[model samples]
Target chain A: MLQNVPTRQTIEAAHMLIAPYIHRTPVLTSAFLNNLSGTNLYFKPENLQKIGAFKARGGLNAILSLTKEQLRNGVTTHSSGNHAQAIAFAAAKVGAKAYIVMPENSPQVKISAVKDYGAEIIFCMNTPEERERNVQEVIARTGATFIHPFNNYEVIAGQATAAAELISDAGVRLDAIFAPVGGGGLLSGTGLSAHYFSPGTRVYAGEPEGAADAVLSFRSGKIERAPYVKTIADGLLTYLGDKTLPLIREHVADIFTVSDTEIIAAMQYLWERMKLVVEPSGAVALAALLKNREAFTGKNVGIILSGGNVDLARLPFGKEV
Target chain B: MLQNVPTRQTIEAAHMLIAPYIHRTPVLTSAFLNNLSGTNLYFKPENLQKIGAFKARGGLNAILSLTKEQLRNGVTTHSSGNHAQAIAFAAAKVGAKAYIVMPENSPQVKISAVKDYGAEIIFCMNTPEERERNVQEVIARTGATFIHPFNNYEVIAGQATAAAELISDAGVRLDAIFAPVGGGGLLSGTGLSAHYFSPGTRVYAGEPEGAADAVLSFRSGKIERAPYVKTIADGLLTYLGDKTLPLIREHVADIFTVSDTEIIAAMQYLWERMKLVVEPSGAVALAALLKNREAFTGKNVGIILSGGNVDLARLPFGKEV
Candidate 1:
């Protein structure tokens, strides 16, 4: 099943296909952060990407790859976060209707974002089984193409474009690239990009300590599930998918698990020093680097700021000066 | 006194002088924002500038313009905001001591930022008279040169670099540019840049309704002071100076006053759509544009995001998810 998966060529093609739609988001560097970590860090700010996340890349690529006949009926996905907005935005851009199945308890902010993109909302129970069932039902009823958030080959290929741009835009070889792992779409895509475009660059996954399944699976050489998922990095709550696991195992150098406290601190650092409004999951990669500063000291590191679709009202540090 | 003030040539020279020290901050565009305003808006994100404000440009240029004899004694400034950090950073870069006179009520976060840059802190009462007296005392004791936050010629020249970059970087002739006016440094500089770099472009000043001194001054053809300052845009509380007034009158096209509520709403809009962490002062320009959408419909407009040095703990929107 993994043999026919997306390679470097697929990512390159996706990059071209989505070039007109997406922004080549800027690469920002902070002297204060560099001095603190003793590393030359280049941040690929996908937080500034379309739909405020790298999910836009994958969503657009997947939707654009669909046949005219498939697009005629529309597309459907189940997500309570950035991917839902990504699909809605991508579908709108491609002139296709999107039916998004989100948990009823989804944040009003995320729900409104999807609605703003003109997607039809289908609310379901807050469980993987319910979401999957609802997504299937919608697809079956409408004959809409089901675009998996992070577990599909084309989505993975689309995500790889971010890393491709990072390397080419930075115009320097990165010693290591770190990305947050949730369903592993970004991490796997990062790995493939490093493997193909900049072979010498090592790829690492930053996982929340509460959701350490990705790290455990990478170490045990088997698929693993989180015993419990509870972290302020809300975007990294999901476990890895089968499509992403093999790619991570083959090309990823290591997986680092960081506590919620560390994630918050990294977010604060980004907010204060870099003046960037990155969401918790977006700061995970920097959290890992800051936690293990010795490992990346004096090296050129590339960090992917995954997204910035944060609930401003519920900031981690609370609402007080 | 205004006769020897900075012109466009001085701004171009300042840009060259501070080229190595300051960041040529990025100009970001949002399709979402464009659609909402019905204008093609280009955002000069000076919030990402060193010290998290365009103040860095003026502070650095002012400090660097000092003679060796002046540098030997050091620099002094009275500021409780981004200007304090800017002077500290600029002094450090120029290998000179910075004596910063900040109010005792200054936020701890800002105080720490100044301290971190190795500037000597002199606390005074939170009043203009007290701040001035303390700054004078510091200058007398250290024989340091005073770098006025926004009134000085070099500082005005430094601020103009942002507009210069925007016009050149965007590679388009803007119909008009909007900049928030506090002491009129940014607005004056923006006016000068438009006068020189983009001759056909018009410069508009965005003033807080609570601090409408600039707008009043513009309308009356004379300097004016705010009767009372009470706005979320704390950075724009200061009145315009003699040096800045001359330049503003000579080059600025108009001034628009926006209410505090509108400023907060615009700030929220930028946060949601642009994923930018701009302070209240930074949002004032966008607020004016949004308020008078008819004036700029389908026209190319440039907005200068003045800074991002807000006390994050006390966000405008209450802490309720």
Candidate 2:
């Protein structure tokens, strides 16, 4: 299943194909944050990307890679977060219909975002089995191609473009690059890009402590799954894919887990100090860096802020920062 | 009183002097906002400026222009909002002591910001008269130079740099530019820049209806003070200065007043859709644009987001947005 991992060439090709569809989101740096962390940090703010996440790169790339026949049949995906909106937005852009499967318990904001992108919503029970079954039912009915959120080679290749841009834009070889890990799409792509674009740069993964399967898998030399998912960073609840695990093992240097409290604290800090509206999952990488400041001290570090599709009504830190 | 208003050349000189001290904040545009307002909007995000407000530009320029003897004597200002923080931060940067006079009723957050920048706080009664009296007393006692928040020519010239950059960076001649009128510092500066940099561009001022003195003054052709200020946009509570009024009369095309509800709604919209953490004052220009969208329809409009220094604990829209 992992025989053909995405290479630098594939990632470069994806960058060219998806360049017109996505925004080259700004790279921000804060002197205050740098002084506090004792490291020179550059932030790639994908929260400003179309669909408010780096997932837009993957979704558009995958949909565009499809043949005419596949496009005519349309596309299907199961996501309750940014990916649903990403696929929906990408499908709408290419004039292809999208069938999105989401849990009934998903927030109205997420539902409205998907609908606003001209996607058809299919509600399912709050379980992986139910979501997959509903997705299959939709795919069977419409003869649509299933665009996996992270596992597909095209998706991984597309996500790598962010790192490619970051390395080229920063114009400095980073000591390490940190990204939050969920399905491992962003991490694997970042790892591959760092390995190829800046060979001296190390790739680090930040995962929620509640859902530390990636860390366990890295230590055990095999894939592992979380017993139960309970984290404020809801985007990191998914398990890693076979396609992404191989790349992670080959290129990723370390995996760090941060508590939900730390993630929320980082999110608050960003909102108050940096004036950036980052979601919980988006702050996980920064949380990891802050928690282990000594390891990154005096080094030039790069961080990918994954997304900013937060539910304003249910902020984790209650009413105020 | 308005004998020597800041000219375009002075503004340009101020830009050069303060270029090393300030951040050339990014210009952001949103397709969603463009679709909603039916106008091509270019946002100059000064909310991301050094002191989290465009006030930093004015403060730094004024301090940098001071003679050695004046710098040795220190600087003084009476402001309970962004200007206080700006003066404090700028003074610290130039190694000058800052004597800040603030109302006793000022928020703790604002107080802390001034303190963090190494300013000495002098408390006064909540009324503007009392605040001014206290500032005079401090100036007399310390022989400190009084840095009027928006009335000074150097301060106005400093603020003009924002619009100068906007015109040059947008690379397009705007049909009009909008900015919140808080004592008319930013508005006058923007008007001057638009007049010189983009000659065809018109300048508009946005003022809160609750504190609509600027609008009344614009209509009456004389400086009119608000009888009693009561607006969510606390930053716009002051009356226009003698220096700023003449510039506004010469260059400003229109002044629009927006209700508090509209301002809060625009703030929420920016936070929810654009993922920008703009304060109520920062959203006033946008509120004016959104309320009267037809006036700006089908044209390229530039808006200055003045600041992002709000008390998160006392948000107007509450926790839910």
Candidate 3:
């Protein structure tokens, strides 16, 4: 069933609830990037957000909105990315136990960050069925509420605030705003905010060619898995959620699919030119904008840099052709 | 003869003169860093400045302060670093030709940046005598006015504005301000600004142990060269100038020498936590502060990150043992 889409008022409430916990991340601009892309780009750096991703907003909101009984038990989620850190951080804030299940092969950096947040980790096999089974076991054992990374209503409401801020803060009207689509949490939230707040501002999604499920879903008006999932954008490997898909289909103007090489090159531009330590997923929106520059030329563009949690030792810069 | 120190009014004027040409550069802080270091650090990221360094402030001030006839003849400088790109960018802004004398083995990233700014490159052997000879040749051929990298009065005035801005913008009064010393242009300027603008705020300098001349000069009451200079802080290889030493002795509280290991570690913290892409030279002051965290335990500290122009292909992160 498609969940009821959040009202603009619900997002405003979520913004107030999470404001003290999350950073009012700066909207950064680059003249060099603007000149290169032939568009004025306003980058809202969520990489500088707590837990180094936009996941902080949703995670904080979801945990903060939980009932006292729910808090008494704890919160649990299964992930191997920024969402895990976000959940751990948010749970710790409320003095609740956070039990996070993760893929056995998660990056050491990410595992260490979640552990640092005092989250109890339960390793699972790297598959949807295995992750679900592990989460069910954790919930059954601890009586903890499972916080869905994106599909939850409160989490979607929380994610909406980032775009609401941009729409309200950007001095001029942006022609379009682009964000990377993973589980469609951020992209769906961004689409909804842009639709309700500034109806004229079109929302766009940048899906990795390796994880091209969102593009298929957008075209077919339903959730569809990619032909194959193999991209450097680790944060964006998930297909769109059922709740997120309908909102995306309604609000997103288009979804652009970019290659891994394009994502790495865009990451390099952000690292070298803008001095931002963005992850591959954080750079996908920018890669999308640059790849199809003609469509955005001379337009005031808003590119939401999603995260900055890459293993610095293994930067894909040397892979640049 | 000791050079007359620039008054606060001179720095104010430099701030106004170069306001259009340079980024005011944000004062950023990380709670994670504050908790780890046991002190509050306000980072002025001049790495985001035009030409990607604080040298833009000095170079632009020097060129803009020049007479029309001087600009008509053009400008020249010797640097294999940010200063080369700064002079090139500054001269290009004023429609004057810039002749930069750089070592033959200068990094291609910096070389290409200078070239991108339309500067005429004259390569010299990696020796002080050869560099001087090349600058002289450039001056003899182009009839360009030689803009000394750090030892000039106007350059010092220009560099002072960064600290002046930090003091004015930081809301809370900084207990102390720290900057890395190369030829002491930025340090002397910072010292003079702090002494005049906020008399209670102490000034300190961070010098690479590999290029530890400033510490000796501070003690001996005269300029001195390092016993043997070798450090990854490539921007801080030069000793203090006659023009800069007197101001340092008058205004600076002390100089701290740090190893390359400390510099890289501090840089890693900035990259991972604060998400700033700082170069080795830029991280030196923070290294000094971190190495001596106890002394600044409760103090509000101001750290000037000088530059962020680094070769991405050759990041020294692997040497972090």
Candidate 2, residues B1-321, lDDT tens digits: the string is 766777778988999999998988877888888999999999988877887899999999999999999999999999999999999999999999999999888888789889988999999998878988998898889999999999988999999999999998875679999999979999999999999989989999889989989987877878998866799998999898778888898899999999999999889878787777789999999998888899888999999999888766556765444
Root-mean-square deviation (CA) per prediction:
1.7, 1.7, 2.0
* Residue A88 accuracy (lDDT) in model 2: 98
Candidate 2: regions farther than 4 A off = A1-3, A318-321, B1-3, B318-321
Between prediction 2 and prediction 3, the one with superior lDDT is 3
TM-score of chain A of 2: 0.97
Q: Is candidate 2 or candidate 3 better by TM-score?
A: 2
Ranking by TM-score: 1, 2, 3
DockQ of 3: 0.55
For every candidate, what is the interface RMSD in angstroms?
A: 2.9, 2.7, 2.4
- Report the lDDT tens digits of candidate 3 across residue range B92-164: 9999999999999997778888998899999989899999998888788878999999999999999999999
Between prediction 1 and prediction 3, the one with superior TM-score is: 1
lDDT of 1 by residue, B117-184 (tens): 99999999999899999988988799999999988999999999999999999867899999999999
DockQ of each: 0.52, 0.54, 0.55
* Steric clash pairs (candidate 3): none
Model 2, docking class: medium
| Segments in model 1 whose C-alpha atoms lie over 4 Å from true places | A318-321, B319-321
The pairs that clash in candidate 2 are none
Q: Assess the local accuracy of residue A97 in candidate 1 as a C-alpha lDDT between 0 and 100.
A: 98
Question: Interface RMSD of candidate 3?
Answer: 2.4
